[model samples]
Target: MKIFNTPSNSSTFTGFILLGFPCPREGQILLFVLFTVVYLLTLTGNGSIICAVHWDQRLHIPMYILLANFSFLEIWYVTSTVPNMLANFLSDTKVISFSGCFLQFYFFFSLGSTECFSLAVMAFDRYLAICRPLHYPTIMTRRLCTNLVINCWVLGFSWFLIPVVIISQMSFCGPRIIDHFLCDPAPLLTLTCKKAPVIELIFSVLCPLPVFMLFLFIVGSYALVLRAVLTVPSAAGRRKAFSTCGSHLTVVSLFYGSVIVMYGSPPSKNEAGKQKIVTLFYSVVTPLLNPVIYSLRNKDMKKSLKKLWGT
Candidate 1:
């Protein structure tokens, strides 16, 4: 690989060549088809949840409202990368414009951040509903729910603005090839002309703080919920409480497990392939599974979905 100088101005650089899963032509085609099916399923699954929430009056409470918003977020979240990935699979030259790359980077991370906050908010809602049931209605009002939703979006987008801007402003060196399907920060940072320890330190600190703190809060919330559920005495009541939380817990595990593996620590130079596989699991697989998990496990969601479909 020949090393060349990247223009000082980011705009002037030709573009990035994403070396995404180099394989035989047949393999590429197979991947394209497989990913296409996954994308369509993800859209349908999440879309159904959104529509179900919208049409069903019974699901108008804060839990369902947050779920609807989460499904909406999943749609955009998967969209931020999968389409471009599909396109890359077909094309011989896997070129992504500088602006386009950064745009993908921005939205991918922003939506991911939003998801983290949304999960925390959802956990908090569950906490109030389960642990403090008497005051749940008064505390988690429509206004408060809407405000929490707004805050998730606002904080998610704002969280990475400075870091992404700073990274983008930095100069890129030769090679101009990203090793992954999407515009990930690790690969992007690897392409930089010079490494800035200060920026790396800042990103390392910022990237994991929200996730770790929110995860701890969720654990605490669930612990209290568990204590409350234990006090209910009746087996049926305990089962119902666990059923309500089961879906959220599953989704949270899938999300946090993959994310912690990928971003909790710095990306290892030799683990690019492992990182890509883990990223694919969360980015592509989890979204498709969420609706299925929620609908199948929760009677309320199943009924709502059935009513929405008129089945």
Candidate 2:
């Protein structure tokens, strides 16, 4: 099927071909099945966390509330790309319309940005809870907690807004094929007929530098947390503090490690396959593991999950 109406005509925008995994039909079927199972598991895992948090009255505190919100964000974050990729796996012509492609591009990045902000906030929560235990309650009041969550969503979505809009408006002449499953900044930038170095620079800064900064912020917060934990007189007290933070630290490591590598430097077109693998690890695998980490690491969350299952 023809992706663009004319191969050379830049103005004619029909759609773009999503060059998803170049596998045999049989491979496509297997991939579809595998990803379908993954999708279900991710949904089930994140959904279970949300339910467990809401169901257990004991988890009505600030930490759990933030967790429930993060779990909810995970649901949408995975939804932004995986479902379309699943559809592409079964499709003969994996053509996504311009609107659809950009929309996916927008949401996928927005959700990812939200995840970064959410992680930072979670790290801050841990810092306050551990480093300044006495003032945690006053600092993280219900109203302030709600406001922080709101700001994460707002700032995250807003982060890439101008860059995306400006890129979308640029001309794409021909070869309307994106190498990866999702519409990403690198491929989109390459496909644009008009060279916009300023946009590229902005995109470059927005993608990785902010993440690197957030990573530093989280690290600093944890450093303070570690100091406070060490100051705890009792071994049990130290264990309790570390245990409270261990799950979040693990998650932060998993997420930022891959993300920094993926967007650490500008992606070369040659690294298409590598990009897909990294994207899958962060976007698909992370959400699936979050419930396990939180529930198993957290005694209260585990009890809640057990009770939720029993009921």
Q: What is the TM-score of each candidate against the true structure?
A: 0.94, 0.94
Per-residue lDDT of model 2, residues 106-210, tens digit only: 899999989999999999999999988799999999899899999999999998887777777777866878999899988888887777888888787778766
TM-score of 2: 0.94
lDDT by residue (1-311, candidate 1, tens digit) is: 42233665655577799888989999999999999999999999999999988988889999999999999999999999999999999999899987788889889989998999999999999999999999999999999999999999999999888777777787797778998999988788888889887878878778878888888988898999999999998999999999999999999999999988877666576687977899899998999999999999999899988887789
Candidate 2 stretches with Cα past 4 Å from truth are: 1-12, 265-270
The list of candidate 1 runs beyond 4 A from truth reads 1-12, 264-269
Q: Ten-residue segment with the worst summed lDDT in candidate 1?
A: 1-10
How much is the lDDT of residue 100 in candidate 2? Answer: 88
